[model samples]
Target chain A: MSQPTTYSLSARIMHWGMAFLLFSMLFAGLAMVQSLQPWHLTLLGLHKSFGVIALIAVIVRLVIRLRTTTPALPDSIPALQKRIAHASHWLLYAAMFAMPLSGYFMQNAAGRPVAVFDLFTLPAIMPVSLPLYGFFREVHALVAWALIALVLVHIAAALHHGLVKRDGVLQSMTGRKK
Target chain B: MSKKTPSALPLRYAIIIGAVGGLGALVFAVAGGLGQSSVTAQDFVNLQEGGNPHLGFRRAHAKGFCVAGEFVSNGSLQPYSIAPQFTATSTPFVGRISIAGGNPTAPDLNAPVRSLALSFGEGSSRWLTAMNTPPVMAVGTPEAFYQQIQALSPDPETGERNPERISAFFAAHPETQTFRNWQAGYTPSSSFASEIYHSINAFYLINENGDRQAVRWAAMPTVSNGETLDAANANALQDEFFARVEAQPVAFDLTFTFANDSDDETNPTVLWPSTRRNMIAGQIVVHQAMPESEGNCNEINFDPLVLPKGMAATADPILRARSAAYAESYRRRAREHFLNSSLQPSPQKESENNQ
Candidate 1:
């Protein structure tokens, strides 16, 4: 049994598309809560819309991962490092699901309905509860920081595989494109 | 998959690329939080009265309370502007009255400048304003203001401002003279209810006839307390304000003093002759004021550029600079207060707090 050379085209597109959306959503969430700028209101709208989009995109991404083949690590990498990589990938998937759900719960707890780009509003699943809102707000913020930290580590690993080790671990995603 | 690939880069290029990428990320991170390398808004905030880093209060006018009110138009402004507030219909507004200073605990009597900032309506229809006790603006331009503040900042080691430096700067920027004179005769208002708040920066009012009129506005207290109120209480002004409002609504006559063709609409520090016709725009009645933590105005930015349809910003650089500086100030205060304090001010789009 041989592993594939790179991710499928659909996976690559979803990967980059969701990458931009998630990065922007994080900053928007941070700045909107931290400031009272009206521009932040628009950001709040975009953040909500993009969060929903990312959530849907991640579901598709997970499905794609299950159906299509994925590249395997090189023989040079350690078993422990491989296990860590696999675990971290699962954690990233967990974060993608949690971020938007936590935000939705936070808004609902605060007695505010989550509106997606003003296209339509999501029915509040949780009742208005200040204590619960605080709880979810804290969770949202903590998870965001954790996710960012994880991303930085992931990037560092990719750079190492590509630049230092000169392995195809990164090229599996980049596909040797200029 | 790990396949042995050709060396992606020369060692020198890899090191250079790594160094540049790291530097770029560092710069981006810093810029994202603290703004550009040469930040101006925080600098402006530092020069404000009682300006200092406070845990959960504004960089200026830290001592204040929230207020809810209505702008009841008297129809006098219909000729000057096409704004909805002038059409004789009552409109809701959230406002804040504050003692000018960065220190929230500053004594009320020590406040030479009082401020009133307001936000009428929400979303696209919102009109935000900030006014101060001074009849005219002290600093004409943002450049002059920056230089003046730089001069006013005390020596880091000595902790004493050089009087000669201030004098020289003022001498160089004579446009600040009107405000200087106002400051020399500074007196705390008898009470918040009796204070007059002036919109020093001129704003244009576009009428139905396609006429653009630049005017300054004021919220003149309906009652004159004549400096009879006691100042011994640290929160004397706020105490009296709350007490009076608890009994009956406190009110102000909103008047817009039209600017003459010869007057300098661009310079805020320059005062037009007192003889200019001051037309009553409306009456602002503040029904009540609550502590900032409990008031609706706590989250409001009160950026002056949030004007309604008929009103617009003047070419005055200070007006635009004020909008920018206010945003920076709001960002700092909101971040500090929301993050550091236990109070959860449920984030709302409709809010107001300014100085």
Candidate 2:
């Protein structure tokens, strides 16, 4: 029987950091849609900063994973389950970039300054148009919903790995060994 | 175990580092460098038709024939006031027409006008609030109006006010021709007040029988040439209004032209023909020579929808939508003002440019 190796310190940090960013982005997006009041300006600023950071972190995370050899799953785990895990992880990565990118496109289409949390404006990425904005806005909203759904599944899978499967799948990231 | 490729790893790392640095610099540059003044007319992009679902949905919701708000006639104000022979009610309302721009200096010459119709009035009373630029809007729908306004704002790419885009809007909405006749002369370099016309899409007149009937009103500036004033004749209207009021409190009559049916929504460009015979229900005088005070002018709420008993608005969806949209605009403006106290600060403390 082989024990699972713990995740590296860098990987752990990236995971937690990205989690915080995603959570804040969700809240900021909600507040932006709800109201454009001055109070929300702070949240907007944070959101803008988060998006840029996420864009950077996602690129770094993918690079780091490619450079390091991640431990193989326990032999007891089915091949189907391994494949599922791989697919889900990549999906999460895709979502990280998709949400902010779509949002950027949406702002560009609206022709308003992408005032990220009042901290600064994003460079113009596109020209304003009714039809074009409509297209990007729809994509942005859809991506947001997809991300939220994926997040729910991720939390559920993490719990399942620990509680039902009684496997070290979830514990490896937590630095615990079964 | 296979070793990671040094070539791939460093390249990826470089890209990540470069992107982070670039993005960080951008965020700071945008935040620190762009001041409030940076939000020029160019920042406001013209919203495309049906492009912004939120606005489109709102405009759709606003469409419908609606009326309510009655004005209390002050019997003493004679031509301006309803007589004792007719019963009158007072309902103060607020109305405003704005050109789509972040700043006042943005050219008012060609952009579509957005009218805010908000009147706090009696249950059955409503007002036909409208814009001055477009004589008649496309589709007579609120959503259409909103979409139109969004489209005339700014170019999404360059963030500049584009005349070509506005011309396209005018082309699409041909009904705006009549209003075009009026807005053509309202150049940024010219005095706006002189060329501005007071429009009454609908009105309530207390008939001889003591019952209220619907009406429409308009104030055509009978200029020195009996035509619209050019920018060259600038400040003529402003000078006249101030000088007359200062010399002696002057009164102007707001005559009412009643319409039997309330569906004047389609024909806004056509002034409800006064030849059909409208009684002089009352007149409104500039009773006081009041200078333009920010507090007084900006805060005061006026809606045509506000009316007294015996007076009611006709069935016009555009008018109906105005009630809600106008109120929301003010509500948002008030909130914006509260959050950013520096907005429209005291004239003395702020830049002379604000004046």
Candidate 3:
């Protein structure tokens, strides 16, 4: 058995799809807070919808990742770099789930409806508790900022592997050859 | 070597970390006291205490006059709501028009916001609605409103707003800038009858099918916009409103605008777009304006939460907080009125006692 040269097609699609969704959610979240009119509401809905989609997508990605064999890092890669990559990937998965779940809980605790695209509504599970609502809201905001930072670091590492290191590590996810 | 079938150890670690992270967040929130309790009726009372000096006047919109009118429904509101006022051909109404601030003697032209509060129906089934000239609320939440009042209140030592304190508050809550900007842009209407007033809180309108839709309403002046008032005149709006109504009737089309998927149901500060679907439910025709001393408006609380069937309040915290605050203000004013009557008799009453 040999190490694979590239990621599976499904993995690549999920990676790119989530990248786009996460970035859009970040931008929309920031804009919504500043906007004082109908546009803010529009951005908020989009952000929530995308967040839910990301949560589901991350779960599927995790399952596929567990099932599929991944390409091993090049032998020349340092142990510290490998460890950092593993830790960041795990943290990203944690954040993907945390953001949407926190938002949903916050909305429920605030006694508000969580509608999906305004087509249907999710039942409020948490009792109306402002303390709980505030707690979750703060968590959601802090986690989002942390997620943004982690994503930036991930991009930098990928670019370093692709551009400076001239390694196939980046190509595994991008499906591009060195 | 094969990639060891992507060891489940990492997956297990990921799940463990995620759970730990979530648990840690809750612990931190509780420990750090980030979970402050919700705004209460006492907070509102404290807010009024900081800003309101006139005990008998409203916390805001203290200067006002009452008008007797009737609402003539267009019969088009059945599709949106089944509220009896919207269904009736004509429902008698008593309304008050007011200028924002706690000082009953505050010059009308200096008031940044104007308001209208109306009650439809003659008895227990009455529907009350309160509206203001601003299309959207200044603050989004009860907490923010409390902070705003504190920031705007005069300093105990200086008897003036502390510039640094107010600026810090604005910096912390930039959303309040929208309200300030709206106020800065306002041009005072010559008379209350010519100003368009908006119900900033989003409400749920239930139709005959029991299906609910979110909406915000506005009373659009049927009369054309009045000339901008001269700021030097202290009682220009009231004088003009009285003279205008005496010479001719004034009216407004009670219009409801449906909320779109993008409209926020919980935040009153976010104004729905003008492009949203709007329909005129009825017309409010004011036939007579009585002097403030003779008017029932002074006694009426005009609470916004007093809703009829087929209409419901949204989850907006600011809207919910308003009911509590209004009730508190009403209680205080009523108590003050009773005390004043007992301590100092009116001129007529004093003369009668002597005779």
Q: Relative to the unseen true structure, what is the C-alpha lDDT of residue A36 in candidate 3, on a scale of 0 to 100?
A: 27
Which tens-of-lDDT digit does each residue in B1-355 have in candidate 2? 2345566655655554565455445433433433322221112222322234222112211111111223344443233324332334344433232343333323334433432233332222323334242334343545555545666656767878788877777788776666666556544322222233344355455544656555565422222222343444323333444454455433323345556563463344454544565454333333332322222234322334434334444445455444433333333334444445544422223335446
As for lDDT, the candidate ahead, 1 or 2, is: 1
iRMSD for each candidate structure, in the order shown: 7.6, 18.8, 16.1
Flag the better candidate by TM-score, 1 or 3.
Answer: 1
* Cα error, candidate 3, residue B135 (Å): 1.2
Ranking by DockQ: 1, 2, 3
lDDT by residue (B1-355, candidate 1, tens digit) is 3454466456734765575577457534643653332435555775663344665456667777889989999888888888888888899888998877676777777777899998885433458899999988667666676787678867667899899999898888777789988888876667888878998899999888879999999999998774455757777788788888998998999999998899988788888998998898789999978886677676666778767667877877677677556645665555555455564332111132331
Assess each model's interface with DockQ, reporting 2 decimals per model.
0.11, 0.03, 0.02
TM-score of chain B of each: 0.83, 0.53, 0.81
Q: How high is the CA lDDT of each candidate model?
A: 0.74, 0.47, 0.73
Q: Model 3 chain B: which ten-residue window has the lowest total lDDT?
A: B342-351
If scored against the real structure, what TM-score would every candidate get?
0.68, 0.41, 0.56
The deviation in Å at residue B58 for candidate 3 is: 2.2
Query: Model 3 Cα displacement at B276 (Å)?
Result: 0.5
